[model samples]
Target: MLKFEKVSLTFKTEGREQHVLKDLSYTFETGRITAITGVSGIGKTTILNLAAGLLETSEGSVINTFAKTAYVFQEPRLLPWKTALENVTCVCGDEKKAKFYLDILLPEGSDKYPDELSGGMQQRVSIARAMAYDAELVLLDEALKGLDMQTKDAVVKTLREHLKGRTAIMITHDKSELEFCDTVLEISDAPISELKHVNR
Candidate 1:
């Protein structure tokens, strides 16, 4: 389980203090998929970073109990020198498990390097790497942004299967993605003050 107790995050930019989160309190239950949707630059990704312990809160506290967490960023963030299969295997050190996810996400490009694959294909490889890791919590930041509709549907289905019985949070601009999640959090305002649960 992950809990944010009046968490606040502030960044210093060019001698100005920018507050991203302000006295925000929320709980992400265990073994559930939560989808976060909001306008651009509203600090949705910052929440994920805080959950993953990649960023520290300026005030308050973040309580995360999950032993392992995997994050798929907006970019593929793959190694240019490693093949798709290698990238996936690098996390879990299991080629068989890596191949299994790659076969589902990037079947044809498993042997290809990051530079050789298209943007969508590279993103798929990145997703496969996270899936292969089998972490207790998964964080996705616009993970399906560039895929075609058909491909996006297929990848979402695959993710749904892999994410079962795990805690997952994703930030997406697409409304259709909300239907697959157990909970949808809609955030607004420049400095996010609250997270509202959107009724499905």
Candidate 2:
């Protein structure tokens, strides 16, 4: 039951304003994945940020029922100073579950610093971190950008296994990613003309 009601967002820097998202409204069913696909620089990440409440909307509401959320950004935002285990342990999300998924996503010898692991391993650590957070909503913004096909498939499979029956919103240009989701939403400059009517 997540929703956006006439939401619009803008950013101002040095007296210059950038319109990131135009007025838009939509809803997502609970316990399902919703994929948002569009060209680059078209407010895709912004939508995920709004849902996670990382940014304030300039107009209208970004409605979410959950107070806790998990965010897996484009880059693996692992803390440089923390070890792989410590990074996931930071959230205190079911110590056993954390270790379990961490073992599933990351392979042997990955229990090292971000600098010590490969790019794909670091992303797996980030995914493990997100899963450890135990949030109701997981917002992923191209979190699998640089991984090779095999690694990406493995990581995606791991995530899906853990995200079963949870709500997830992902932004990806790859049509293949749509297979992981229940609904495919295409956002663009074109307007949604039809308005559905519901009775009280």
The digit string of per-residue lDDT tens for model 1 on 15-95 reads 999999999999997899999999888899999999999999999999999988999999999989999999999998999
Model 1: number of clashes? 0
Candidate with top TM-score is: 1
Candidate 2 TM-score versus the reference? 0.89
Model 2 segments beyond 4 Å from truth? 190-200
CA RMSD for every model? 0.9, 4.2
Q: Residues 1-108, candidate 2, lDDT per residue (tens digit)? A: 688888878789899987776677788778998787766876788888888888899898989997678989998988889888878887754667668768888867
lDDT of 1 at 106: 85
Looking at model 2, report the run of 10 residues with the lowest lDDT sum: 191-200
Candidate 1: global Cα-lDDT? Answer: 0.92
